[model samples]
Every structure is written in C-alpha cells, then in structure tokens.
Target chain A: MSQGRERVYINDVAPRDGLQIEKQWVATADKVRLIDGLMATGLARVEATSFVSPRAIPNLADAAEVVQGIRRVSGVGIVVLVPNVKGCERALASGVDEINLVMSASESHSRANLRMSPEQSLAQFAEIVDLAKGSGVFVNGSLSTAFGCPFDGEVPQSRVLGFIERLLELGVEGVTLADTTGMANPAQVARLCEAVMTRWSQVPFTLHVHNTRGMGLANCLAAWQSGVTQFDAALGGLGGCPFAPGATGNVCTEDLVHMFEQMGVDTGVDLAALIELSTTLPELVGHDVPGQVAKAGPADRRYPCPAGL
Target chain B: MSQGRERVYINDVAPRDGLQIEKQWVATADKVRLIDGLMATGLARVEATSFVSPRAIPNLADAAEVVQGIRRVSGVGIVVLVPNVKGCERALASGVDEINLVMSASESHSRANLRMSPEQSLAQFAEIVDLAKGSGVFVNGSLSTAFGCPFDGEVPQSRVLGFIERLLELGVEGVTLADTTGMANPAQVARLCEAVMTRWSQVPFTLHVHNTRGMGLANCLAAWQSGVTQFDAALGGLGGCPFAPGATGNVCTEDLVHMFEQMGVDTGVDLAALIELSTTLPELVGHDVPGQVAKAGPADRRYPCPAGL
Candidate 1:
C-alpha cells in the first residue's frame, strides 16, 4: 500500500545521548564495546559520542577517546554530537563521519539547557558549518524542543521553521527535529513533518522522538506515514536531557527496528544483534533500562504452545 | 482534518480482562469502587466482570455479586464477559447492559483456550444469540487471536473471516477483533480490519489489542486509520490470559484515549478523571501496573522551570 517496502534508517544515539545523563559513569571501554555492538548490527549510522565540555557532562568526558577506540565497521557512518566550536574541533580531530550540532527550538529551553538564545546558537552554527564545509565531515543541525517545551507550554511552528531556515542557510547537510520533552501527538507529528518535508524534500529530516508520554513509536508511525524514513533512538529507551527531567528518553532502537521490520518495512539493522546488545544495557549502565521488546521478545517470537495443544 | 472531531468509543475492560489474570484477589468493595471510578470518567461502556468457571479462572469467581453490586452510572453501558448459557443467564439476571462472548479465531487456540472446535463454538453461540435476541441484551462476539496465534503461527485471514461469517449468521449484534497473544503488526491490523469492515460495514466492530510485544497502540492506530472505532482497553494495562501465559494485557484505556483525544479525536471520556483512576490501580491490585501516563504524567503536564529560566 505504501508503494513498496520502505527502508528506514536508524541513527542510534545510545552511546552519546543515553550515557550522557546517566549518574553512573559508564567506563570508556564499555562505551566502545556498546558502539561496536551497535555497529555490528548493520546500522548505517550510529552516534557514538558527544564532544561537550567534560565539566558540563562528566558522563561523556571520555567522548573523544570512546570515538577513537571503536573498531569502525565498514559502510557504517559514525556520528558525534558537538555543542560548540571546541566540540566541533574535537569531533573533527577524531575523524568522525558526521558532526551533529545541537540547539534548542524554544528560547526558554535554550536559556535553561545551553545558556544561549536561539539567534546566538545559530550564529555559532554558521562558523561551525564554514569549518566543516571542507573537512569531508557533514554537519547535521538538531533542533531540540521542536514540538513543545516544559517551560514554554507550546512552541509556535513558525518559530521552528524560522530556525530551520537559518540552519539551511548556514549550509548544514541535514536537520533533526527533536521532541525533546516528548510533547508530541500523532496528528501533530504528521502535520509538522509534512510541512517540513514539503520545503526540504531532498534534505534528510530525521525525527528524534522521546517516549516520555509513551507516544514515541506512535509518533514515529505517523511521521513514517508522512514520509519520514530516518529516526533517532537509544539502546534501552535511555537518555533525557537533565533540564527535561521527566522526559523518558529517546525511543528504543531495537524496539523501533522490530516494529518496522515486522510491518514489512526494512530497517537494515539486525534485530537479533541489537536485542542481544539491549540485554547487556542494564549491567552496563548499573541499572535496569526501560525497553519492552527485549523483555517481551519480538512480535513473531512464539512461546511454547499450550502444553496440551 | 478528520471531519472536525471524530468520537471513538473506549470500553474499559480492567475489571473483566485486567483483574481476571491478576494473582491478587481483589475485594468486592474495591471492584465496585473501581467500576464506579471508571463510570465517573465519562466512559460510555465498561466491562465490569466475567462469569466463568471458578475452577478455570479463580480471580473472577465473585463475578455475579460484583456485577450486581456496582453503582450504575446513567448513560454508561455496563457489559460482562459470559462463557456459556449458564454465564449468560447469570449475566441476564444481574441486568448487564451487554454480553461479551469470546472465542479464539485460530483453531489451535480455540482448542487449547476454549477446548472446543470452531464449529462447536459457533453452534453454542446460536443458542446464546437466540436467548439474547428477545431479552433486549446486546451480544458482542469477540474473536480472539484474530490476527495471530501462538499455537498456530499465522492464523489465515480466511479463517478469521469464516468465523466472522458464522458469528454474523448466528444473529450477533456486533463483532470484536482481538490480538490475543499480541502477535499483530500495523500492516496486518490494517489489512484485516479493512477487509472485515468492508464486508460488515455497519457492524459495531471493535478492536481488542495486547501490548505483549508493545504493538498495542500502534496496532490500534492502524485499525483506527482503517475505520475501526470501538476498542476494549484495561486501566493500568492489567491483563493477560493465563492460558496464553506470556501474552500482555489489553491496550491501556487512558493511554489510547489520551493519544486519540490529543490527535483531535474526541473519546467523550475525561482523561484527567481516567488518570486519577489509574493512580489508584497499583494500590488496588497490590502490585505495580503497566501504564506510562500514571507515572510520566500527561503530555501537557509541566514541571518547575530551571532556576535561570
């Protein structure tokens, strides 16, 4: 019905987004191991680390080391999150494939999380884009809080589009619309994605959703129906910005992949490998993670039939 | 966009489906209180209890008393699950607004769960439908495992439609398609629901989905998009058939309602009241329930802003 089977690209952000907010420090070796496991799953893209200030996010203090340590899988594009020009330098120095720049769509969120206004953040992005233009490493601009903000009840769509306009003008290769606080509904996701894709039809627009209100996958379905093929998910449904405390984290990568593949949509990533990696998350993070697929198993997974039958 | 506001009916099955598999024996008073609370949430239909062999499901042994003890809310239809003539007669005596009859769509499932062949099950339904015809009680025929069965890997679409054909011929007033073992995907749900609705256009077709593999709401969305309106959900997602041991509970009523209502679809139920009722479930059941809204709060629920912001 949707033409032919669509291949959805999963951009795993577990190592970077997941562990960044964790109070328990994941050792650098473990970080590399998790990234390697994800790479072996045949994912086309994986966000391995964030080059943010060590003092700000101590959990990812060994970002550059973790990036350098991973055994790069052939054909897998490695990505790293960068907060500023220093992070950009660090990521470029690590030979990353993509440099993901972060900024908040809501001014209140920008002030609380990044301590900069949207305009100031975009001004900084211009310099980063110029630096990455000839570095062979593409820049992806992520607009956080694109849906709604905790401090600001509703973010105007015009405000989000204006920021996207500025990011495109800065020559960023792509954009990721993030539901930072999980304040999104299926209808809202469909409408916004359609509008954005209408203008940026060729540029890849990924949906970075959270499961905070448990609409992460639902929003993804809506977005996919609206022609979005790329998604940002963490390993165990882990990670939420500290500023947005109650946000559940990104949608689980394995869970998302399982649902898509079972629906006849191709996610390219190997679910068995991802699920095996998912089982090790609790031990790796020193606490249980919140993903249902790993515990419940995949959709087609059958249990022993009733004994008598 | 969806013709102004579309109203979707949510049938609360926490009492019948939710507590039926719960190990803890809830007091009759608590059952009545729960039904009453659900009534106050403006739900139009609620499945209060199931009258089955106590030997089979001891959890709902006090079905009759519990059904009669509930304080009826005006304009709300109270339904009960009935297995046989005896159960139907008891439900009639208790003055139930509707009688929900269930039989598995898969032959293997019917044999293991209902311990009868599809032919034998339909033959029994004839007498029950005849009894309900003149008694002014509506009979909702529920076909469990309509999508997939654990025992029989994939239940053919032909098999499900055959059951629907027999049920409709048996003089049933409505039909409900259930994903008993949670072995349904969005594509499968959309295809089956579309086929069934196309054939039985005007019937009050309902969807009863499980979150076993976390595809409950996603399947519901697919079904909804395919024009299936009525849905059966449990409060706090408190159910799983014992015979189908690992299968999760029905979709969470509040979660589904929240998603639908937020998408500009009217469910005619008060989410705040439903959420308040969800908070009391863990204490009522003596264990935690599987619902996100109660823990994470609603999408609009806001937290205190950071100091600077």
Candidate 2:
C-alpha cells in the first residue's frame, strides 16, 4: 500500500459505457447534455463516447455527432473507447482527449469479447499505443474480466499481471483492471492489487467494478487499501456487459463520491450537484436509472412530508 | 490484522431491527414465519423481535407474541434488541438466548435516537447486564453511530473506544460498532476496526452497517481485514434507523454471503436459500426490498439471450 494520503480520481462513464448496453437509442444532444452535466459535478475526465462501428454497438450510433455536439467546457477531458486502429483514428478525428483500449484477461472472454487470442490482443494494443504515441491523447489499457471469467472460470493472477506488464511496456498512461463479469470479492481484489502494486508501484491503475453480486464497493475498498484510487463509474449505474449475463452497471459515481467525501477523502465532486444531474438522466435516456442514492438522496436528507407528493 | 483463516458468523436482524422501520404493520404470525425462514438459512443467531413499547414502534406491537410463537429450531440462538431493563426483562422472559443493548457513541445522535446521554446509556447498560447475568442470557453492547453520526457530524474514534471500554467493564459478551448512517469509508473503517481489535482481540465484535451512503460493504470489507468476522445483516437490506433521516438497511445477508463466497471465504450460509428468502421479503413486508443480488442472479448465470434485456 502507498504510504500517504490517497487521492481519488473519478472517471465518469455515463455517456459511452452507461448507454452502450441500453437497448433504447438516446439522442446525440442528450448524450452531450449528459457529458456536460457529469462535467459540471467537478469530474475531470468523462468517457464521452465509443469510436466503434455503429453495427457493433448500435446504442452508440451517434458517437461522432455526440462528440462534436458537446460544448468543450474547460478542465473536462473527454475520453472515448477505441477497439483498434480504425476506432483510434475515429477517436483522434473526434478531438477526444484520451482513448481507452480494452482486452479481456481471461482467454475465453478475450476470444468471445474481441474475437482474438491473447497474443493478438497484445499486438493490437501495441499497434494502437504506437498510433496514439504523439497524438496528444492519453491512453488507458483496460483488462476486462480480471478477477474471474464466465467461460474460463477463475483467472490466474499471474496472467493478469503479465498482461499489465505488457501494457505498461506499451507506454499506456494508465491501466484499468475491470471486474467485467462482477465476480470479484475483497480477497481477490486485495491479492490482485497487492501483486500489481508490488511489481509496479508507480503505475496508475483504475478500478472498473460492477454491483452484480453486491461486492462492487467491497472490492473497491480492497483496491483502495491496496493503493488503487482512480475509478470508472456510471451515473445512475446505467451500464453492464452483455457477455456477462447477470452483470449490472458500473459502480455508481455519485455513491462512490459520497462515500469518499463523507470520510474526509476529497473527491472534488459536489454530491448535491451530482444528485441534480442524476434526475436529468431519465428524461435524457428515456428510461429510469438504477442508482439508489440518486432516487433516495444522500444519507442524511430527510424524506419530505408524504402530503408534499 | 488477523493471522490465519477468519471464520465469519452471520447474525440475521430482519425480525427485530428490520420490521421496526416499515410503515406497514405485519401480523404476529407473519413475523414468526419470517423468523422461521431466516433461521432456516443456517444463521448462527437470529434477532427474534424487540420488546420495546408499542407506542414507540407500532410495527413490533406484538413483539412478545411473535417471539413466543417462533418454533425453537435446533442449533439456532435467538437474539433480541432491548432499550432498557424493562425491555431486557421482557426479552429474557421470552426465552431470548442473547440480548443486544444499543446506545449511540455520538451524544447528539444518542439524544435524538435514544433520548439519553452517552453516560446515561452506559449506566443503563451496566444495570441491564447485571440483570441479564443471572438469567444465563448473553448481552452484546452495541455503540451506534460509531463511525459517524448525522446530528453530531464526525464522531471521534476516541469516543467510540471510551464507550467500548465502559461497556466491556459491564458484563457483556462484546461490542458492535455500527456505521449508523453509513458515513464510513474504507480508511475510517480500517482505522476503527484496527483500534478496537487491538484492544479487545477476543471480544465478539460484529459490524452493523447500513447502505445509506453506499459504503456498507466497503466498511464491512475494511472491518474484515481488521479481524471482524461476525456481521449483522437484514434479509433484503430492509432496515433503517428510526431516528436517522434517510438511512437505509443493514447490509443484506444474501449480498454479504455472496461477496464472501465469491472471494473463497467460508461464511457457512447458503446464498441460493438467501435469495429465495430475499424474493419472499416483498410479499412478507408488503413492499419490494432493496437487495440487487436477489433480483439479479449470481454473476455467472447466463440468460438465454445475451443481446440486451
């Protein structure tokens, strides 16, 4: 564990990851408004959209328009998920500030998710990192299904560490170990984080957790204790993996920030403003959201008199 | 820090603490049925019912009858929460195997919640423990708002330890440090649990966590690393503090057991049965519960169609 006060960096993933799995098609303007609202809460980075083929993720069909339509507010960096060299080109053209490359740590999930072997995925990562080298955009390599795989069962920690070593060598600015299938617990998270931090103490790692088994926050706490602070969260917990059947959305950003702030750990995000943004999600996405604190307010807000309703 | 394997004990609190906060009035027989169902989940102990004044908590008006009606399932110890000597007398008369006496660590919350000072509450604990000693009933002294209190703002760790020292002097089994409003983060939880365990390593401490701020499981995981094993959870996260505004339930038993089981920790509780219990809670309590794992299956179960729900 790091020997000082922990600094928490929250990456809001509402626009891209949150809505990608949604069957409903949200408008480009709504997506822009969502990113703007998320930025207004003091989050420095927001995953604005995915630069992928529309046929692959039809929910994010208007990625380019959504990116172009958003008013570039200062201090808010927009990031996009790029699958390969083609997606990286689209992301660079969209003027995004950062690009995230994802591959599964589990071989079975890697094959099913990206349709490539582990070595091929590593090669793809190298290619994308090389392309984005001097593009003024940051790179984050995400290792999905880092805890356990739906198809391959429990993934060995050694394999995940090997992938991280390769990605770090590729010169990616950050790495995210995702509980893609929501199979992580505190022990596994602690063990994995210990292994990773022991080898690379200076490597910045982000946690992408899901509340599928209700261990989302627990696993997150384990990682925090092990010195991983940056997190990817969905507003209203509005995303999930289609490959993992029972998986839910990413850990709710508002809830995570609330927890951090209450304990005197500065998240630099306003809880009340985040709650207000949470209300705008339903109208923007055309569906109710899943986050509990947004629907229920913060921990100490009193319920209004029943007659008020 | 705990050495070797840590054995986890689950304390089901759905019957007493859970039903007390609901607006709907459950019948006495239904309360017994809920208790029976919880006991069948193989919980080491189940909080049967509270013997508080009906005017104070109308939901448990028939608390004595409900406690008397539950079949004494073999190997399951019954626990009941008591506010004073009178409540403890009634609980002991109802054949409760354990008596849980609760007081807030924060004086402000104690005044609002229990209508007493911290000193007055500890004095009451001394009397209650003295009375229960001759009856062969175990007493667990719980300090609410141990992490942070709503009215008092931040509760200092020293105040919690002082309460523990005073309570330990009384004839009680152990202390339960509660995050009454879920204001605990991983750091705060780890610090508090470490301090407490360092002092009373052999004492039977349990964590009574609420999910109000979404740090319930995180705090639980921190406590686990600090050597806490016994936890008090409701069936479907169906309880909240009667006095603390906007508070949610205790960590759900099914959710907690699922987290531990996925991490390879032995909880000795069944998740499938807990989920079955979770589904029936809405019907029993006259409203839907807050647990996500029950509605969403375990993370690995695959639905027939992976293409979006």
Candidate 3:
C-alpha cells in the first residue's frame, strides 16, 4: 500500500468559501475572530476572505475589514480568493500573503458560475498574475470542477492537465484541484492525483474536496496515498456548492486533521484547539454545521461505564 | 498500493442494529417493508432483526414478526443478532439463514453492555453453536469494541485475535470486527484488519465501523486497502452508539455502496434503489437521517445552467 507523506498541510477556508453562501450575514468582527481562531490552531494557511464583488457574495462584503482586523502570525500564510484582476488589486491592497485565482475546468460550469468560459478565465488569470508580479504575494490558481462538473458530467483528465499547465505557465506558484460539486470518487481521485503529482514533481498541489456524497475524507485518503500533502478544508464543514444547492461543502478541517493524526501522519495542526473552535460554529452560523469530531469527540476519548454496569 | 478486491459484499443492518435504539417505534409492517426494500436492492445480506429481549430494545420487540414477514429471496442471506442461547434458539426457530452472535472484545464494554465477561460470552456462544449445529443456520460472530472501547480505551489486538480463534473453534462460520463506539482510526483499522486477514486467510471477515468521528468512509477505505471485502452498514445511517449517545451510527449503507461503486468496485448492490429506500427513513423513524447521498443525490447527478447563464 502507498503510505503517503509523513507530514501534511491544511488550509482552512471557512471564512471565505464557507460563509460565502450563507443567508445570514456574518459580522466583519466575527469573521476576523474566526480567521484568527483558525490561524492560532497551527494551520498551514487560512483563506480568510474573498475579494469578489460584494453584490455577488453579500456575506463576505466586508472582506477588506476582515483581512485588516485579523492578527498576522509568522509562518502562517493568509490567503484570499480573488476572482479577477480587480479582486486581486483589492486583495493586494489588503496585504494578503496569497491570492487564489478561480476558474472551472469544465466549460459549462465556468460559464454558469464565473460568468466566463475557461479560456476567458485563463486570460483573466494571466492579468491577475501580472498585477501581483512583484508584490511579494504568492499567486495560486484553483480549478473548480476539476474532478467532474455537475453540468457537464465527466471532466477529461487531458482538459484538467492542460489547464494546470496553463496556470503554472502564467506564474501561478501553486494549484488546487477542487471537487466543486463533490463528484470525485476515491479511484478517480487517486488516478488523477497520482498523474498530476508524478508529472509536476516540483509543484505544490492541494486537494480541495466537498462531502456532497460523503466521499470527502475517502477522496482525501486516496489523494494522500497518491502523494498529496496539502489540503483545503472548512471549519465545521461549512461550505456548499451554490450550483448544487443543498449539497454539503468542503471537507471538515477538524475531521481531516483527526484522520491524518490518527494515521500517524503529521498534520502540524492542533486538533483539540480546532475542535474547540468548531464548537462555536453552530451559534455563529445560526444553525448546525456538518462537522462530526466536535459532536462525537476524538477517537481516544474515553467515556465512563454506564450507571448500572 | 493494495487494490484489494474487485468485488465487495455489503450486509445491511438497518432493521436490527439501527432501530434498536430509536425512541420512536417503527411498526412491524414498516420494518418488513424496509427489509424487503433493502433486499430488493441486491444486498448480499440483510440483518433483519435481533432476537434479544424486547424489553432491552423495545423498538425491535417485533423481531420475530419482521423476520417472518419479509420476502426471502434466493442468494441473499437473512441474518439476525442473537445475544444468547435463547436468542439463538428464537432465530433458528424463525428460519433465519444466519445467526449473528455478538460479544465485545474489551472487558468493560462486554460487562457493561452484555452483562457478562468475554469468557462468559464465549461460553454462551459455544452452547449456541451447539444448538444451531444441525439447523443449517450459518453461525457468525461479531466482536464489538474490537477496535477500541468507550470505557476501557484501546482493546489489545492479542485479545481480539485470541477471541477470534475461540469463536472460529466454536464453529462460527464468519467473524466481524466492529468499531462499536466509532473510536477506531484508519491507521489502526488498516493494521488490525491486515493482521486478522493475514492470520485467518480462509475466514470470511466483515468490517463494521461507526461514523462517530467522521472517519467512517476513510476507515472503510483503509480496511479495503488491507484486503477486507465484506462490510456491515446501516441504511440511512440509522444506528447510533448506544453507549455514546449523541454520536452517529454505522456507516450509511447507500453511501458506502456509492463510494465503492464509484471506485469501480462491484458491490452487488443497486445504488439508486438503495438511495430511494433511504429516502423513506424519515417517515419511518420520525427524524431526518444522517445520510448525505439521500439528500445531495449521487455524484453523477447533473444540474442545469442558472437562468441567466
């Protein structure tokens, strides 16, 4: 069996991707506090907020304030999602450590979700990369629907590989293959992740999965077995696919860390602290979140014998 | 990497282990219909009910009625949990294809749940096995808390292995290692499953895991990677750890089947039919279940382009 890397890296995206679709608007101060709490849990990175148009995503309207209000810790990268050159400029002005540019691997999903074709999104990424050229901010490209698009069924490996090459060629320092609609299976994840890791031996690739079909952690395991080390997760499993409405979103950060840590893989995350933070999410979001570890406790948690026994 | 097996076997325990703890009583007719619905989905087996005392599990008080009412199809084993010689006799008299004898691997859990020690449970199993000798009923042993115990913490592998030997010697046709309280990790699962499979190559072993810590599917993947082919799942994720009150129950049946089927492994199950059956769980049990696929649809489900796009 392929025993993956000894250490893994986690980037919590609850503030940006997670809260983007919520009906209730999260206060800017609370967003900052959530990001700060995430950062203190020894996460490799935290996608704090997004720099998209406020009208498009009202929940993250105070992105700039959220970025500015959070404490910056050394060695922890603060990332913000940037949809285009305009968002990139705003994210740069906010002094973010990294700006993640978004696009979709499938044409239909790209047009429907981003209001642009894949080719058009690629052209925009080039412009965004150009703007961040010497600003000391890392540029990362995220390809949505990299596994399978909800509108277009299967996304050919050739198409995903071609897009990854173009993103890297445009000076994007890293790439994240996102299962935007949670269509990824473990076998597909292993095959694609292995192909990408082998072809791009030097690139830092992150696996971003959703638990829409309950395969989030399973796909993560398959990717790790295929040599992936970085992952994008959301606190309390808070994110959802806007296209697929009720489907659950990103893999829960605490659950992922718990799996890796239990496997003896070093995630460099404080799971207890992360679980503690996850507890406050239900009240913060005005509803129950999908996270399990917070409710179930850790694997080693011991319970007292039942009263009569 | 270990590709494990091309074909997997799934046994649904929804009617028994699942309803055992529900405060809402599912009617006997509904239980029969549920089992019939599950059996029609081409499951390898359906653990229809448990022959334990009705007072102990009032929801399953109609176990005999359920087993007798369901349509028994050829090639699909009908199994029932039997706690003692009395339960075993009741199961055999009801004409069940298999009698699942359960005992916890850990001391505290065995005493707390079964009101007996491991030795006492084993002694009772020998008597039950003797009773079922000529009845043509397949005898299966399930070791609960095989991975870990809620009160005693980790259950040593030596003790589990020793118990498996005793069960096999007592003429148990199969063995299932159960992570009863959802306290198992993937690494531990892979290790223990590999050990048991290696030591008992000819014995049919099933893996029963809980989603309490959100490692349900991941642990299943690990066990499959370690060469386990048979699994125990609950429909709609209906079961919960009675000892750990708020924790989620057995890995959802449809979700497990979906993951394996998506991975290109044939589980001899109809995913659509299983998912359709999962949808009726809310009305039957008077609560929304924890299953994701029933709510999110399958990974291959397609969505239409937004109105403007």
Candidate 4:
C-alpha cells in the first residue's frame, strides 16, 4: 500500500473505459497509440482493455491485440477488466500487471449489467481472487451500484457492507465503491463511508463515481472525509453506464487530479501532460470527449469569451 | 441565529446578483414579475436590485422602480444591493427589508469591479453599515474575491480572513465569501473555512461560489465539512464572473439546494418550485439562463432514454 501522500496515483482509462461507451469502433492501432500516449504522461496505472465476450462489447473486441501491440512504459502498471474465469485467463495471457474484478451490489443491477445474481457474483469474485492469488497477480474488486441502482431504485447500505465483508474475506487487496447510476448524494455517501470506516478501518477503499446527478466530486470529498483516499476517474469524462439513464460520463480524471493537486493533496500526476494527452483523443476516438477541463483548459488558460455576452 | 437545522433560509438573487452580469437589459416590470414569481414559491429573501449609478450598471438602472412595482408578498423579505451610502439610502427608500454591501478582497478586483481600493471599499462598507443601522435596515456584507482572484491568481487565505475581521469590527450581521473569479479548489476552500471558523466561531458565513473552474460543488462540500452552511446560488446558473476566464455561470441554486436536501442537510427550499421559477426566467430576462437542473429536470425525474448510443 503505497500511501505516500506526496503523489496522486492516476489510473488512466482512456483506452478501456473511455472507448467502451462510444458508438463508433476505433481501430486497434489507434487504441494502442492512445494507451502509449497515456503511459508517456507518467500515469501510475492504466486500464488497457476488457477481455469480455466480443458479442457483448464489440468496441473492445481487439482487447488482446491492444494489450500485445502497445509499447509498455517501464514503471506504469497496466490493468485489465475481466468478466468471468475465461476472461481472467485471457487477461493473464495478455501479460498485464493487475486485474480489476467488477460485481454489482444490487441484485437487479447485477442481473442487468453482468448477467449474474448477487450470490453468483460473490462466488465469481471468490474464484477470481483465488485465481489471482495463485498466479501472484494483484486483485482489485469493484462493487458497482454501491450507491444506487438504475433498475432497482435504492440499494440498502447493509447490502453494500455485506459485499465488502465478503470481498475482504476473499482476500482482495482493495475495493472500489462505484456509483453505477450516479444516484449518490453527499449525505448518503458520508453516512455509508462512516459506517464502513467504523468497522473496516484499514480497508483500502476507492471511489468510482459518475457525474450523472452532478455530485461526483462532492461524493469524492465525502469519501475523503471518511478516510478513503484513492479515486477512479476516466480521462476526458468518457464512459457511461449503458444501463444507467442520463448517467453518461465518469468524473474527468484530469479535472479530479487538478482539484486534488491544487488543494495541496498530491496525486503525483502531471496535469499539463494529461491535458496534452487529451488533445490527441478526439482523433483517436473519432468524436470529441466530454471533459470540460480538456476543452476549456485549466483555470489559468485563457480563451476568447464570446464578444458582448 | 436561527440554527434550527430543518429551516433552511434561501435568499433569491435573480433580480440583483443574477441580473448584474447579464448582457441584456431586462425591463423593470419584467424584473418585478420575476421577483413576484419567486416570492410566490415560498422564498423568504429576494434580492431586488443594486442601487449603483445608471452608467455603471445599465441593466439595473431602474432599481427603485423594479423594487416598488413588485407587490411585496407577506413574510417575504425583499433585499437590494447597496454600493455605498447613497446606494444604501436609495435601497432603504425603495422599501427593501435588507441591504447587501459588497467589496472585493483583492486590490485589482476591487478597483476593477468597484472602482475603489480595498481600503476605500471597506470605508464604503463602514458607511453603508452605519447608514443601514441608522435606518433600522438589516445589513449583510460580502467579501468578493475571497477564494481566488482572476487578476492576482490565488488570493491568500490571510487576506480573506483579515477582511472578515474588518467586517466583523464594522458590526455587519452576516458575511458571504465569494469566488469572484471562480478559482476555488476544494482544498483551498477547506483550509480557508477552517481558518475562518477557528477564529470566528459564532459568525455565520455564506459561500457565494462560482462554477468557473468546475469546482463549485466540490468547494461547497469542503465548506460543509468546515461547518459553514449558508450558500448563495443563482437559479439556472445565471451569473458569470466578469474576471475569471470563461467563467460564465454561478452554481445553480436549485442544484445546490437539491444536493443539500438529498444529503439529509435540511435546505428547506422546494426543488420543484425552484425548477418552475427557473422556467419563467427566460421570458422575464429576455433570454435563457444556464441552469442545468431546470432543463434536465430533477434526479428522480427521469425521461425515456432513446435507443442505444
């Protein structure tokens, strides 16, 4: 657990999470180029691709090739998403450093998103943890829909806690509570974090929040107050919950890192380099990404405000 | 002194703070109509106009007439901005219940916005406070450019606290710390609020944060942690910072209130009513305002998502 507060650990997901939600199919080489560019920016971690079935996510069908073709930077850790045991095996073959296992908290959301119930997902998580442990690979579990579910309105706090306990028992190193539907308010976040912190004081928790209800950063602050430090954000605010309505963008990684570093909290990531990486994204992904900071630049960068208005 | 957590005080500013930066000159009757509509929605405080010189702010030249035309609703407190002693006298004559006095913390911003040095502006603040006290009118002082200034880059925390101490010495009842250039990062906000709260434990402070750097909501959460509750926001994200580059909107009042209420924080204002009031704004102001909650509807209010992206 590298808890040296001097730097922020940026997990750039421009290749995996950023491209997965787009309607257009980006070429495999373009994906590799984007990943290479992100790695050059000194981002500590990068999610390269998901080894899910091609029939489900056509955009990431070249997941294996993207991982194989990219010129890997020496110090950067390349992580990939896995759906099931087969997906985990595929990820191991790609020669990645880490594995991210995702499961939904709400039964309704789990069925809709991953096509599994809560019990089945928990069983899968245990198997994934066991597999990673045997192969000497690190495992990070994501409890999606921890905040609220689009299919099922409100997920009980106990359910989220229970899932965390189960994942901890499975020997997962870290956990991320995701706002899959962006239904989290600060108070709910505060109350839940306080409860979890009271019990599992040493558990490493990360926040993966969406800006759907416009409380992404606020929710992050609430989690921060409760002693959770790590945050998961997509560069350029790309990626959306295909099932979560109107929840169309992740908290922009550049924007989050900017806010953190400016506050004197070190995320160890370079914002200028991240902004530069953002510039080449539109050509790579086909359409412009939705990050406001990327398009408008930082607070100091000036632009021509419309005349007279 | 009303610390009853259930009763949240909402001070509507569509007429004064909201209209000052607007490029279009709204008619006096339309302003009155907008105020009337806002009042009908159970609002207690509505800022009617600024008593500045006609040439200085052309949009609010007919300040007195606008205030006088509105049939002041029973129990609704009409407030107006008073730039100096003369403005205070004029606002009192216009039959407003409260007077708002503002001065920028940064010297450059104070000169650009108020045409006075910080010392001169504080002198004006003292005179206005005295005039309001003599006339039995309530006075609320605002420290603009408290967070960060567009001209001077980051405004020091010491300068902001020093200004607050000066206002407290002047017997000002309430104070608002404004992000005039919208350069507030969450950490900066948290550190400043802690400083203010540690020094002045009893003084009530309101945050008038702008969304220029996209940290408006994050700054709000930081303040919430520091125990400062009141906030000033425009409905429809109406106003923009005259100095911060591309900073073209205030934090939407409905959005702020919604986030607060959802977190069980008791911001007594009605979100639905605020939304309805936002809809009537375009016709009254002769153009559309920039609030997203009004256009996108509330978090729970969902629309049918079209076919997959």
Best-performing candidate as measured by lDDT: 3
Tens-digit per-residue lDDT, B1-309, candidate 1: 354438889999999889887878999989999999999998879999998998998988899889878888898999999899889888998898999999988778889889998788888888888888788889999998898887677888998999898898889889999988777888899899999999989888999988876678878888888888889999988887544444347788888988898788999999999999998988888887777777677777766778855
CA RMSD, predictions in order: 1.6, 3.5, 1.3, 4.0
- lDDT per residue for candidate 2 within B1-309, as digits (tens), equals 225445688898888878888888888888888888888888888988888888898888897898889888788889988999899888888888889899988767777778778899988888898888878888898889898776666788987898888888887787888887766677787788888888898898898888766677787777787788889888898897554444457888888887777666788777888889788888887887767678667655553422321
Rank ordering of all candidates by lDDT, starting from the highest: 3, 1, 2, 4
Q: CAPRI band of model 3?
A: medium
lDDT winner, 2 or 3: 3
Model 3 regions more than 4 Å off: A1-4, B1-4
DockQ of 4: 0.29
Each prediction's whole-model lDDT (CA): 0.86, 0.81, 0.91, 0.77
Runs of candidate 2 with Cα error greater than 4 angstroms are A73-75, A115-120, A166-173, A241-247, A295-309, B241-247, B300-309
Error of 2 at A288 (Å): 3.5
Could you give the fnat of all candidates in order? 0.55, 0.41, 0.80, 0.23
lDDT of 4: 0.77
Cand. 1 TM to true fold: 0.97
Best by TM-score: 3
- Preferred candidate (DockQ higher): 1 or 3: 3
What 10-residue stretch in candidate 3 chain B is worst by lDDT? B241-250
Model 2 chain A: weakest 10-residue lDDT segment is A300-309
For A84-149, candidate 2 gives per-residue lDDT tens digits of 899998888889999999988976777777778778988988889988989899999999989888
Off by more than 4 A, model 4: A1-8, A241-248, A282-290, A295-309, B1-8, B243-248, B279-292, B295-309
Q: What is the DockQ of candidate 2?
A: 0.36
